[model samples]
Target: MNSLLILALILFGFTSFYFGKSRIKKVTEKGDLRPKALPHFYGYYQALWCALPAFLIIAIWTVFEPIILKNLIENKIQISSLNEISQDELNLIYSQIISFSQGNFSGQVTKGIEAGAITYKNLLSISQGAKVSLFFCTIIAASLFAFRQINKNVHAREGVEKTLTIILFLSSVAAILTTIGIIFSLLFETIQFFTKINPLDFFFGLGWSPQKAFISDPTNLTPQEAKDLKEAFGAVPLFAGTAFIAFIAMCVAVPIGLYSGIYLAEYATSKQRKWGKPIIEILAGVPTVVYGFFAALTVGPFFRVIGDSIGLEVSSESALAAGLVMGVMIIPFVSSLSDDVINAVPQSLREGSYAMGATKSETIKKVIFPAALPGIVGSILLAVSRAIGETMIVVMAAGLAANLTINPLEATTTITTQIVMILVGDQEFTSAKTQSAFALGLTLFVLTLILNFIALRIVKKYREKYD
Candidate 1:
């Protein structure tokens, strides 16, 4: 039933879009020159006009229907002389109604709940049916109206074009609003975190032990005892661990990924890419969870033996093991994106340089690489973002100890690891530890946004040079 409604909506939208466009075309071609915008633009305008309003209504209706309907039904049930019920009883009735309506409840249904379920079903049917019919009617009518408006001196094409421009503007605004919503959610939660934990302690404190915070005691600590909690919330070690891992991962991934990317884009024969590309992409499809145990059990202990031979200390869960594995994980991310960007660099520039007696390597370094630098940098930043956001490798191989030291043999933690630890056990939502997760998440998100913005700016400036 739900699938049928969705199909009906899609058909209604498609029909309105095409039929509206054709109507404009027919009217404009009938010795009328000034059609409002292009015929295609008129179609787009009509389709958006028809679809957006109804879809938005449907979306909003879906979100609030339960709450609104439940309230109305609850009030009706409470006032009934047929009932002697408490708030909890009314709530139970509401639950049963919802469950039964959704085809979830199986036992014999009560009269009030059964009636409410019927009403719920009726409301869903009416809303969905009305949306489809209303949009269809609106589109058909609007198309006819637009067609009638088209005449010899009507300037129909311009009107259609203007409407299309508005549609595009609205779409862009919607995207921006969504981004703003995400940022606000992160920001608000971070604020809650700061309220519970000292901002300075979270940011500047040197001891980094969050798991200890979770190691609950039966006796709640006094205020003075809690003041000592600052000793455990060290940002320094976590920051160092994160940087060390990222740097090591980059050490392995960067040269290999960049060279592979350059080869695929600039040097590879078509046949080499036929198998190589898919083979490389296959690496990305492996689950991170699979990589987790591989890093922890295999690489961690393997590195331990190597370090023992070399007379260097190596913890079973060392930063090196995790970083190396993570680098291998992100190689495709670096290679694939860089390959496309490098390929996009103008062939004319490369040919011109080669014609000037520049060696292949010289042309690549002085011309091709410079031209593709912005895109390459963008890809690297994206990889960095991915590395920073990665959780599984660190959680498994990079043992969680918020120790403020960078020695790879010593245990260390990451912001993500801290979040997982703080929130893992029975967390008190109002506690400083739980809220710290939000603060870390916000910081990560903001850093990624900054990197992305810089990358885009570099790419844009580079584009202007050629364009």
Candidate 2:
């Protein structure tokens, strides 16, 4: 029914556009006066008037229809059952009614649910019918009003442009507001987490055994229970592991990705580029879960075998294996962005370098690299962010033991891996264990934001020098 209403609206809008253009053309043909705008602008103005209000109404109805329907069904159930149902039981009854309406009810049906289902079905039918009727009425009224205004002196172009400008401005504002909303949500939860766990202990303590603080009810704990909880939320180890793994990944990715990008941009034949670039980019398209599997099943075992051959103790799940696979996964990000940035360097710079009797290598090293340094740095920073946020590969290849060792052969955990572990199963939101995930997430967000800010400053400084 909704799809049919949308189709009708679209057809009406198109028809209005055609009739509006024809009306203006006929008016100009019969009279000596000309229109204030072109025929197409008038057509667009009529089409917008026909479509925008109906679209807004449909969107608003879609958002609120389920809430209104659920309330109506709940009221019917309460009155029919004489208010004997508890809130949880009512919720279950609502679920059963919905299931029955969808023909997927697996539970035994009761009289109250049957009556609720009937009420729900009737309400849904009426709501859909009213929606279709109101939408059509809105379309007809708006089209007629717009059609009457499509006379010789109507400034259709100005109206259409102003409408489009307002739309663009609203879109930008929506994006900014969404970002602000996410930050505030994380901030609120982090504050709640810190209230339960001391900020100094969380930040500076050496242990991270969240299981000690895992209680079913956080609010009812006695003072001794809280004191004996042995909660150690020290994040230094996770930060160290994250930085170490990212460093290993950058070590593997930067040289290879930069060299491949330079080769593709400067030296590769057209056929080589056509075949090679896609093959490199295919790494990025592979699912992270698949990479996790590859890390666990293949890379980890292979590293263990090599380590045993040399009589070195090597865990099957180690930071080295995860970092290696993550580096392979991140290669395409670096290579593709670097390739585009290198290609963006002006040809004149290369020509000038060549005219100075410089070799190809010298021209690239001195001229092209310098000119593209800002973009190259930007791409590397993006790759660093990607590595920092990766969770699955680290979980599969690097064990979730928050070891503070610097050795890559030892099992270590990252902030992302710990976040996943802390919130994996059923969790009480008020528990210190669960809220710690929010704190870790907020820290990661701030770290990335700071890294980006520093990267921008560095890029700006170099960009000014080069320009």
Candidate 3:
């Protein structure tokens, strides 16, 4: 019924647009004075008025409907009950009522439940009918008001532009507010986590075993227990693993991606570029989970076999495998952006370099590369961020053991992987072990922010130098 109402409203909006346009056209034809705005502007003006208020009413009704239904059910149940019902019990009874109403309940039905279900059904039907009437009344009233306002003197274009500006501003505000909300949520949880564990221990301590912090009584820990708990949440290993994996990924990505970008931008023929660039960029569209499976099932085992042949011990789930796969995944980001940036370098620079008796290689080395440095650096940093934040490949290819080692052949875990491990399954959110995930998240967020700040500074420096 709601879907039907929405479809009807959309049709009505379209009809109102055409009607308003034709009405305005008729008004202009009858009068000597011309309209201040275009006919389509009046159409837009009418469409907005005819639909916006009706849509607002529907939105408000949809939001309040569940609350209204729940309140009515609660009141009905309360009146029928003999004893005082607790909130949990009432919630449970409401669940049962919902199940019974939906024909999913298998247990014996109580009189109160049967009565509640019948009342619910009747009220829902009545509410649906009322909503339909209200929606039509709103549309009719709004449409009439809009039609009456269509005149030669109406500044419909100005009104539509102002309305659109306001909507765009509100959308920007919503996006900003959402980001602020996420940051605050992370900060609040991280603060809660820090209250339970020492900040120094969490940030700088070598060990990382959050499961060991699950004590019998978290609130009242003895000195020994407190020491154990302090040592349990150490994040140094996670940080090391993240940096090591990201470093390895950069090692694999930078040379290949940069060279590929340079080749495509500076050397490739049109035919080679058209085919080659898209083929390379296809890597970016490949899903991360697909990369994860490739790393886990193919790359990891291949590395293990190579290691065995060489008389070296390589873990089947090794950081090297994850990093190599991650590097391939982010290659397109670096290569595509670098190619664009390189191509954007001025033709004047290359011509001047040639005029100075510089060879093509010299022109490229000293002129184009320097000019495109900022964007190239930006692309590389963006790829580094992707590598750091990646979870799936690390989870599948690299084992979830926070071993604080620099060995790429050994199994290691990143901050993201540990956070996933900490939060997965039914978790006690209030526990120090679970809240540790937030702390890791906050730390990772800060590190990424710092990396971005550095990248910005570098870009600014080089951009100023070039510009």
Candidate 4:
């Protein structure tokens, strides 16, 4: 019903646009007066009037209809059941009623449930009908008002522009608010988690076993059970693993990516660059899961074979395998951005360096590079962030055991991988085990934020010196 109403509203808007345009044309032909705005602006003004109010009404109704229905259903249940159920049980019953009304329920039905489902279905039908009727009335009234206002002196352009500006502003606000909402949600959950586990143990403890914290009821743990339960939230291992892997990825990505960028920007023939750059950047389009599969199935085994030949024991799932695949994935990010920044360096600088008898390599090192240092730094920072946030490659190639080691040949895990592990099943949000994911997430967020701040400071310092 809602979809059909939206379709009707769209058709009405298009019709209004034509009529508004024709009205302006006819008025100008009959009188010597010129329109205050273009015929198209008048058309847009009328179309917006026809569509926007109806769209708003539909949005409001969709948001409130379920809430109103839920209350009505709960009231009916309370009167019928004598309010014998707890809130949780009531919610479960409501869910069953909703499922049955939608013809998706598989559970055994009782008389109460069947009656509730019938009531819900009837209410939904009435609500949908009213919603459609109200939407059509709104569109019709707004269209008539806009048509009457369409005259030689109407400020159609101003109205249209103002409406568009408000829309864009609201869009920007929505994005910012969404980010704030995510941050605050993580913060709130992290606080809940910390209340159950000590913040110091979570941050500084060396152990990473969250399974020990699992309890059916946290409030009723016996002293021995609490003592036997070694809730090791020591996140140092996860942090160490994340840093070690990112460091390895940067080591692999930076030199090769920078050299490739330089060759493309300065030395590669036009034909070579035209083909080579796109092929190099194609790495970025390859899904990270594919990289994970390649790392797990192929690279990890090949490394094990070579390590065995050299009498060095390498784990089947090692940080080296994940880091190598991740580095390859990040190469395009570095190379593409660095190439653009290097090419952006002024030609005059290269010309002057050449005139001063500097070779191409020396000119690039001393002149062009310094001029483009800020942009190069920015590109590297972006690549580092990409490496740090990666999860799939690490989870597939790097083992989940949080082995706090610097050796790339050993198995290790990262914060992201562990978060995935912690949240993989049915989670009770109040349990310390499930809440630890939020804590890990909050810590990762802080680390990323700090990295960005430090990068910005470095970029600003260098930019000031260079510019």
Candidate 5:
């Protein structure tokens, strides 16, 4: 079935290419008027016209196929036994029926199961077959349509190129829609979680613990479960932890990355850049997992030992280890982006400063740095986001105690770490624990979005001055 779909897609591309090339030739040779676009534009136009709508149909079909197929099976399966089942129970039965249909059922298949399985198998087979058939139909139709318009005397090139420009615009719009869809999905899930828990308690509570209030075992939950599960899921610890870790990381990273970027951009000769740049970037290439172990086994323990010697109390897992290591990891982010922004400043501007008898340091600090401030701010915001969302480093090195206190030596957990803890390994999505992950995810998303917005606004405001 996959092979058939691939074949149809190949035919779609081949026919469009042929028709477009043929149209361009006819316009160039037979038409008296000069062509408005190059021959390749015609090919691109027809290829896009033929492929886009058909591809969208395929993509949409693939996303909703499983749900639609399940419903169609429920309708077609002649078993009256499923009629009395609730939606959840029916969904469970449907899942098993699907497993059976796919020839991977673990249990004995009764007659009713066999009948439903057969229907589901037939539906899946027919739906996929229809996709392949429709793909070929769209190809043949679009190819013939393009070919017919590209007669021996038609102006096919101009018409096709104009169409291609519109197609390109449409493709960009799709990205905007996809972003909207993602935001809405996150918002919906967050609303559901908040409905189960008080928003105020979740946001402002200082308890900083989730494991304490979660009805860990659903089987053991009483007949009547208490509502307002949000009170149990406090964001204070996660929020404080995220801010504290990011603050520590920025403390470690910003000065070093900023000074190095300044030196590289303004002071370093070409020879210095040739060797030093890659060495700096090598730090970025090291895997986060390796950093995780370094944080867990080496840095955290090392800090604890150091703290003990200094008469300070340090936990086995300290925020200092994760934040410090994360800071090192993101240094390349700061340096590389800052370097670009600094380089973007016009040499003419620098020369103007020098002509005014400004010392090099004075000129750089006053003229060059101010000119590139926007880019530097943009890079810092991006690094802030990286620090906030970073998981592996904090998860291993910073303990998941959700301690709301702000001691670097004490154990703490971030939103990302809690999300990981809640969803990792075995998870039951119906529980508050699992829902809290989504809530945390929504919070993380909102935080990043706001940070990015501020960064973009600052960059834009600065860009206007330079422009």
Candidate 6:
């Protein structure tokens, strides 16, 4: 019923929008008066009037309906009961009533419960009817009010713009508040984790094994047990693996992506540009999990085969395979951004360089490259962030062993992978093992924040020089 009402409101809004547009258009056509705004603005005003009030009514109804129903059910339960019930028991009874109403109750139903369910069902029907009636009345009343105000002097455009601006502002505020909420949540959890585990050991420890810490009680630990706990979550291996994989990824991505960008922006014919750009961008649309599967099933085994034939040691799940696949996945980010940045370089600079007897290569190398350097660097930093945050490819191809090694042929794990591993199953959030995920998360957040700050600083510094 709710869904149908929403659909009806949408259809009503669209109909009102077009009707308002046509009415204004006809009024002006008959020389009734000069319109103060475009027909579309009047249409927008009508649509907003019709839909916004109805949606607001729906929102209020949706929030209060459940509470009101529950309260009514509670009253029914109280009346039907012979003895006073505790809040917990009342809540349990309410849940059972709801379950029975929904045909999910498995236990024997008492007379009180049966009475409560009937009351709940009847109340729900009444509430739904009231909601639909209220929603339509709002739409009709608001639409009539807006239509009455549509005149020669009506500032429909300004009204619509003001409404949209307020909406955009609210959306931005919501986003900012959400981000603050996430940061504070992570911060609180991290503080809890640090209370159990030493910050120095967590940050600078050489080993990474949360399993050892999980076996013992985090609340009360012996001196030796505490020492073991400290040593267990070294985090150095995870950090090393993350950096190693990202470094390998960047090494492959930078040269290939930058060159592709250069070719696409400068050297490609118009037809080639049209065809090639989309084809390259198609890589970005490919799911990362698909890349992960390719890495694990295809690239990893191929590398092992090559390694075997050459008699070099290679793990089946190696950082090389993950890194290589991740690099391929990241190519479109670099290529597309770098292409845009390079193309944004002034044509006059190229012309001037050529007039001064510089070749195309020399002009690009000296003039275009220097001018576009800031944006290119920003793109690479963005790609670096993308590579660091990647989990699936690393998880599938790089293996979950937190081996603190740089050899690409060896299996290793990243910070993200370890975070996943730590949080995957039934976890005791109070234990140091579970809390360690929060710690890792906080550390990763800090790292990403630092990278963004550096990228912004670099962009600001060089952008001033070039712009």
Q: Top model by TM-score, which number?
A: 4
Write down the RMSD of all candidates, one decimal each.
5.3, 3.2, 2.7, 2.6, 4.1, 3.3
- Residue-by-residue lDDT tens digits, candidate 4, 66-101: 999998998889888754767788789999999998
Per-model TM-score, in order, reads 0.74, 0.87, 0.90, 0.91, 0.84, 0.88
Question: How do the residues 130-209 of candidate 5 rate in per-residue lDDT, one tens digit apiece?
Answer: 88778768766876666665543345466666676776898889989998898887677788777666788888977655
- Specify the highest-lDDT model's number: 3
Q: Write the per-residue lDDT of candidate 2 for residues 1-467, one digit (tens) a residue.
A: 77887898889889888988888888777886798899998899999999999999899999999999988887777776654778888788899999998999988998877888888999999999899889989998998889878864489999999999999999999999999998998899899988777787777766787877755565677877666454568888888999999988999888889999999999999999999999999999999999999999999889999999999999999899999999999999899989999999989888988999999999999888888999999889989999999999999999999898899888999999999998898887887788889999999999999999999998887772444
Residues forming the 10-long window of minimal summed lDDT in candidate 5: 222-231
Superposition error at 312 for model 4 (Å): 2.7
Clashing pairs in 5: 197-230
Query: In model 3, what lDDT does residue 431 have?
Result: 88
The local lDDT score (0 to 100) that residue 5 gets in candidate 6 is: 79
Q: Determine which window of 10 residues in candidate 1 has minimal summed lDDT.
A: 210-219
Q: Ten consecutive residues with minimal summed lDDT in candidate 2?
A: 223-232
Roughly what TM-score does model 4 have, to 2 decimal places?
0.91
lDDT, residue 91, candidate 5:
79
lDDT of 6 by residue, 383-460 (tens): 999999999999999999889997999999999999999999788877788888888888999999999898889777
**Greater-TM-score candidate between 1 and 3:** 3
Tens digit of lDDT per residue, candidate 3, span 180-232? 99899889999998888889999999999888887767689898898899889
Give the alpha carbon lDDT tens digit for every residue of 1-467 in model 1.
43565566677668767876777667657865556466766666556555656565566656886687788778877776465888888888888888999999987887877888888777767766766676557555655555455433355456656766887999999999999998898788788766556778877887765545542441476666576666656576677777788887888888889999988877889999877878887878999988889999999999899989999989998888888899998899899988988888899998999999999889888888888888788779878877887889999998877655567665566778877877886867666567667788787777677878878887777653665
Candidate 5's TM-score reads: 0.84
